[model samples]
Target chain A: MRYEVDWSILARPELAALLIDGVRYTMIVAAVSTGVSLVLGTALAIARVSGSGWLRWPAELWVNLARHIPGVFWVLFFYFAFPELLPATWGSALNGWTSFALAAGIVALSVDNATYVSDIVRTGALAIPRGEWEAARCCGLSPWQQWTCCLIPVTLRTVTPPLANRTIHNFKNSSLCMVIAVPELTWATQQIESLTFRGIEATLVATLFYVTVALALGVWARRLERGGYRHWRGAGAVWRRERGELARVDSRR
Target chain B: MVELISVTKRFGERTVLADVSLAVQSGEVAIVCGPSGSGKSTLLRTLNRLETIDAGDIRIDGQSLYRSGLDLRELRAKVGLVFQQCHLFSHLSALANVTMPLVKVKRLGRGEARAQALALFRQFGLERRADAFPDELSGGERQRVAIVRSLALRPKVMLLDEPTSALDWCLRAEVVANVRALASRGIAQLIVTHDLDFACAAGDRFFLLQEGRLREVDNYTLACCAPEALRGLSSVPRGRLQAVAA
Candidate 1:
């Protein structure tokens, strides 16, 4: 197979515009969805651990349903099914909106990723020792304050590896937006392939982009783990030095 | 002052604490001792409403914990708890951990809270370790940091649940000594332990809990002389008593 690839497509002004637009749309969808998923997921996690039957049942059902359902189904549902369920005027406005693709992508990704985020946070929250809760209560922290201060920080640190992995997963899942004609990276590549008959090269370039970003995120996560470990080591050294000094002072006394 | 009145706790069919009643006056050090599974921990936990009671009520400074509409956060601020596991926040520096309650719960400014927390760390001889994380500290050091974090709020009562249980034999003495120093500062303390020596040394008064009920013992002399009296009332098996003694 003698493939004469036209590398000029990369430098074309029209292609450059599409690539820029694709990256912008992709980032906007991912960032908005990440924020929405984190807040909703954290709330779901708290409800699941609340030990109340009402809160637990609904939270579990939401997580299970979201996790089991295919991500593509959510994209289609938000883009199609949801509009029909709304009031006629509102439905038409949403359906006819220019930002419909962006809105649909955000909604689908938020719902799909929120389930995994909530599960990650819940595991971290539950792993905390019962004694920490006692200590928080003893300090007279309001339930809300305790949740925000003591519980959230520890849970976030403990679950960061998984949570960061999920964020990267959501980033890749943005490629799925091409199905709804959102014109992200995959969609841009397809456009190039159809116009220039250079599908393989375009796809290979896109794949490299995804791989590079994902690998960089993985490295950052590893650094965070090492930083936490180093912090623990520093504390131990200081403690020993203090004890030694105390002993010296006592001997002089 | 804290009081537990006819409190009972059950996990499904298993009864952890059964119809227990006790009173802790202001500035008193009450040490609770028993074999494992004797419900000593459950009693201490109930004082701050950490473990909810299935029956009866727990009153802290005249506020009923079991009653609806009580502010649990304000109530918790008045009562401080230290755990045997030294559950310090792994992500936070020691100073940040100590200052957390002061800033978040008490709404103190960061500088003000840090100053207070640093003073607490100094008091516990942990000033140098304030910038260190929990995992970096030794067992004894971690427990001291945990105590400082709990006491930073200036709680009226401190609950020490096996504070030295997680430490090695060598480390246990140092942690117990810090706890004894806290007692001398006139902080009301309730210590739950299986270590007879630690209980005798740290507790101003001892209480033997068996089968969810507590009987006060004036001192270690009485506890040792009438071991049978405690054993007779306790639901714990004889084998566990020998294990505890060993």
Candidate 2:
């Protein structure tokens, strides 16, 4: 038996709608997860650095545990096992909800992505000189103001390229949600294959979507490193120039 | 004015500052100099409460530093500290480095903070370098910017730790002039340094910290004989040094 490719099958109205819905859900999960994980990860990184053991230890434990586990396990666990842990009626209600899989997917993805971001951001924070902290404190800026006005901005700016790359990885990981029947882009491709036996065309389209978006994100990360943006958006560029100039002056002296 | 009333600090079983008493009048420039491990830096840090004392009291402008209900932010804002490395915020332009604290801590409007920062920049001859980042500036430029940043807070007392350590002779002279300018403005200064020339040129009074004890010495003694005398006293314990001085 030979496999015949028919690209026209995707033109069917119902099939097209399913693919459209799949793209929408895929983007929603990716975008929302990225936003949530960036915030949570930054906070977690700060917590791990805080002077109090209460904040630091718990944050350390969470990052360590989440980092070692696989992303698929988190997705499945949240979808299949989490509802069972809730109270009986609530568990049943959660299981009965139509969008439960989508919610679970977002939570699982966010949990997994945040650990990587936390590690990256913490590295940037530590790389800052001890002098910066002393300067801020000596100026009498409150601890909260110090973090917001100085530390967080510097750390996040320094780590933008790696953070952007992680976001791209998380966008691709949205495909993992299909295991729990979340019906994202990959699931739509499979559905099209199953119904009309035109899996090739659908798979090609889905692959193109992933490749195109991922490439765009990669270009953005590069531009951030190179200062391709008009605003003072490239902190890494500025940091490099600063180091280079200082080194040149030191040698002359 | 700044005062350290019998300020004492200990680390584990070792004493870093022992019964050290000193004062700087409103327009005075006091220099503290000593051999390495003699706690010159520790003595400076204690004034800003960067190092808490095991016992003793510190007062800036007649208000006790460690008093209950005293706001540390207020205390720090009143007594500015410039470090040996002049740790300017590398992420900000020199102008922003000064203005940020003004806007954030003093609640100055942005325009007001900019004007104040620019005025200091002009006074220090750093107006041309205001847009430069800390790393982009030379060592002298960076140190001046750091001092200007602290001054923008309008501190009553300024503490400088090894200001001339990283500078050439020309820059050292610039710092001496700067210290004199600060004193004329009535900002009392406590400078920690090993440069005897800088101390003699910039200080109104000189102090020596040896074996954790602070003692005032004349500028001539510090500049001429203090180095040889300090070397001779290195082996003497605190008690023996006190007995010998007596």
Candidate 3:
């Protein structure tokens, strides 16, 4: 079968509105889910390495289960299974609400994304030299202070590239909301496609938007990496210059 | 003052320290010399309770470190530890690393802590490198920064585990000089090293550790002067030293 071009449908004003709304919804879902996942994942990462069996076991189990389960299953579970388990009146209210889809999407994405975030953060924490921990202890920092003041900053810097990749993955995964009839980019594109029988046009534009945003984010991350490298290099050069001057002065003496 | 009473430590079936008892009086500088795997590092770590003793007790300034009714954080604040590999905080500037404990643990105001940190950095000849990160400094500079980071808390006692063992020959003197300066200020120090030269130059008192037991050598000058005795006390076996020098 041959595909037919539909340029008229692509030029419609209503189609643009749908695309704009879809983009806004996708951004919102990704932002909230990312925030939740970052906090939850950091706590889980700390627990896994805390050397306490009580904490490590639960954190490990949570990460493993979330990672093994499918994202779509989580969305369905929250949307369909969770309300049924609630008390009768609350369940009814939840099912009747217009915003239930958005909430379900947030929960689904947060759970799915947090496992990867925790894994990234755990690797960063492990990579820190053991000497750093001893130094913190010698300085009399409490366990909380050690984690908050010393560990997190170093871990975040080490893991930023991977963490940013996860954020992009989370953003793309927002497309999964289409299955639940959430008005995200994919769902809006499908709505436009069915109404006008111009699926190709809507699909192309949506794909373009996603690719552009992801590339823009990647470029920003590269800029950050370059800036960090330059700062460290300049500092290293200055140190070497000072050391050389001191060496020269000693030689003269 | 820190005292260890018949402390023993075991990992699995391997015994590291066996019924070893020692006392370090206030303002005393005691250097511990032993071979690799002789439990020298473990012994020093046990003083700070970093490694728990299997038996016996460690007391810091009349308070039992291994017993209840003592605040471990307070005890740790009073005792500083420096490792062979300097563990300056990678994320913070040298000044921030030095000042972190003052602000976070001691609750000093930011301005006051900065002033104190700047003074310590200057004292250690790190004033120019105060704003540098750990990765930005040389190996010698990083070790000096590590010493200043420990001294920021003004701990009464300092425990050093092979502080210069990881340094090159050129960098070793700078670290040893810093340790000597700390000792001159009347700060009690327990330095664990296998280097005969460092032990001779930096130690006021020397203890030879072998097979998990310690024998104090009271006359350090005589010990250093007599090459045979010094070689026997050193972790390096006689044949290996001859081979390396030859």
Taken over the whole model, the C-alpha lDDT of each candidate is 0.78, 0.86, 0.81
DockQ, each predicted model = 0.46, 0.35, 0.45
- Backbone clash count, each prediction separately: 5, 0, 0
- The residue pairs in collision within model 3 are none
Ranking by DockQ: 1, 3, 2
TM-score, cand. 2 = 0.87
Residue B221's lDDT in candidate 2? 79
lDDT of 3 by residue, B1-246 (tens): 888888889998998888888888776789987667788888888888788888888887877886667777888888888887878877677777777789888899866887787778767778777767788898778878878877888888999877776678767777778777887777889998877666667778888777778778864433443344444444454665465446
Where's the lowest-lDDT run of ten residues in candidate 1 chain B?
A: B229-238
Best by lDDT: 2
Residue A84 alpha-carbon offset, candidate 2, angstroms: 4.4
Which residue pairs of candidate 1 clash?
A: A139-B77, A140-B76, A140-B77, A232-B136, A236-B136
Worst 10 contiguous positions by lDDT, candidate 2 chain A: A228-237
RMSD of each: 5.4, 6.4, 5.1
* TM-scores for all predictions: 0.85, 0.87, 0.88
lDDT tens per residue, model 1, A83-184: 999999999999899989889989999999999999999999999887676566677777787788678767877888998899899989888788899988
Report the TM-score of chain B alone for all candidates: 0.86, 0.92, 0.88
Please write out the lDDT profile of model 1 over residues B1-246, one tens digit for every residue. 778788889878888787777777776778887667888777877777777879988887777887889877777777888877877877567777777678888889866887787667767778767766777798888888888877888787888888766778666777667767767677778888777667766677888777666777777443455556455433334565565477
